[model samples]
Target: MTDLTTAFERVELPLETPFTISRGTQHTAANVVVRIEDGEHVGVGAAAPSRHYGETAATVEAVLPELLDVVEEAGDPLALDRIDARIDGRIGDNPAAKAAVRIACCDLAAKRLDVPLYRLFGLDGERTVTSSFTVGIDDPERMGEKTRTAVDAGYTVLKTKLGTDDDEARLAAVREAAPDARIRVDANEAWTPREAVDNCEWLASYDVEFCEQPVPAEDPDGLRYVYERSAVPIAADESCVTLADLPRIADACDVANVKLMKCGGPRQAVEMFHAARAHGLETMLGCMIETNAAIAAAAHLAPLLDYADLDGSLLLDSDPYEGVPMPTGLVDCSALDRPGTGARRA
Candidate 1:
């Protein structure tokens, strides 16, 4: 049996570009990369938790010591099993950190076995997934100009950030700029129930695909109201963090947005996907600001869902490790055919 042990390393890579939003700012991305090594085999996972989801670099950093101990004690053969068992309760409410460790272990395990991570989930290697490029909060003209650039770059889908005074104009500008591109909007829980419903209705003029997290997470009733009133579909982001949140969220949401960080790990994400499907909810795979490792893990789940928002890595100026190469709004899953996550630590 491989003697698996977990190790943590911090990486700081500049964004090939910077992504700005209403929440705050991110320059060079910082993430903690977890490595699970069992003798000759190694698995890698990377995670970056955002403040919008109630996670920060300092918190992820502080949690690593405890995670290392958990991996060391669990050993290689049972490393993932043990990690899965304690992930939810021990990690408190921060799913992002636990997800990072889980991904690393899976990557290491698959690498050891000389197989791809998706194959472990019983998925074939021939699936292609399309991703969405995000347009952060900015001036309407600038937002429109960015949208035009992205569209010209061959991004078929665009996700625009809203939560400020200029949201209406921004949406209009982007629509005018990228007339043929599929558009979606995410409010990041910035709107109230009424505001969400009202804004979503206004957005209908542009024919948006859906509106995500229109209202605050805790306001399920408000979400339901927005869903019923809005012309476009409503996808729940902050509102649906766990399986438990699904039932309540499903009542109000037309779709569920699943983020590996918010869902805990790949295993839990799969579980949630199953539950969301069972509830007859359309599903979207979302991501936080992360490296290719986390983005790759999330991409594995995209083939199993209807919508994907795993473009977080593209917003970064530089990716430290080479795993899955992101081509704008689509994922080149050709790399996923290899063993592990196809990520090589730098």
Candidate 2:
């Protein structure tokens, strides 16, 4: 084991536009960035918290000192297994905080090994997936405009926010704007089972690829009800937070949407992906509105994902860091020229 040093800071990132979902809206994202250093190398990570998951930037900031203490005590950036276990032991919740520490450790470890994060995981950098750019909830015309803008930006897939009274209108506008784009919808647990079932029927008519979190996570049966009756495939975001959720949500939804913040870290996300496959579920990776400091690390996991919604940093008005390059929404991990998750000061 070697000596390790750690620190954290909070950064507020403004979005290019106000982002809205079934839950609410925000014009800025609050992220807490973590750094772990081992004499020569600094590993970077950030926590993008969600109110829906009971975390905010304040919560992440409050818990990080204790989490960083765990890393310092472990004293070895490469000792991920020990550090990860100790972190979980320190805080059973506060997943975003834990994730920040985990991501930093991985980044530092990869830097020490002098390899790209994907190469460290023995993944094929050539095997890639295009991330879906999101169009947050807006008026029908605005939604159409956003869809057209994303398509013009070369995003081949788009996920739009729905669950409004005028969901059909919103979707129709988006489809009309990007007829060839693969469209997906996320209701964000805003609909009841019956409403979700009815919505999915029309969602399929609009050629939606899937419907995400149609019913509340609190009501597992309601999710299953919608899944069993819906015309489109169902993806569980709120319902599938950790590996334990895989078994419970396996029969209820077809896709398991894993977020690094929700799962605690990259390792945990890998576990969830394999577990999801075991349960006959497709795997997807989603992100909160975040900085490239965070989203860059998640990009390395693209090969493991059946679908990637990692456009978090792309939504930012500006990012202080640059990670992997996603030209036209294609996550080109192989194009990463440097190691350590490809995150560097921009």
In model 2, state the lDDT of residue 307.
96
Q: How far off is residue 98 in model 2, in Å? A: 0.6
Poorly placed runs, candidate 1 (over 4 Å): 16-18, 77-79, 334-337
Which residue pairs collide, candidate 2? none
Candidate 1 accuracy as TM-score: 0.93
Instruction: Put down candidate 2 lDDT per residue, 1-346, tens digits, no spaces.
Output: 7888889999999999999998899999999999999999999999999888899999999999999999999998888999998988888799898888899999999999999998888888998999999999999999999999999988999999998989999999999999999999999999999999988888999999999999999999999999899999999999999999999999999999999999999889999999999999999999999898888889999889899999999899999899899998899999999988988889
Candidate 1: residue 51 lDDT (0-100): 73
Taken over the whole model, the C-alpha lDDT of each candidate is 0.80, 0.93
lDDT of 1 by residue, 1-346 (tens): 4456777777786875556666666677778888777777777888787676778778888887787667766676335667677655466877788888888877776676677778777775566667889998788998888898889889999999999876899899999998888999998888888888788878998999999988887777888988888888999998988888888877788899888988888888888989999998998889887888777777766567788888777777767666665676666655554777777754
Which is the leading candidate under lDDT? 2
Per-candidate TM vs. native? 0.93, 0.99
Root-mean-square deviation per candidate: 1.9, 0.8
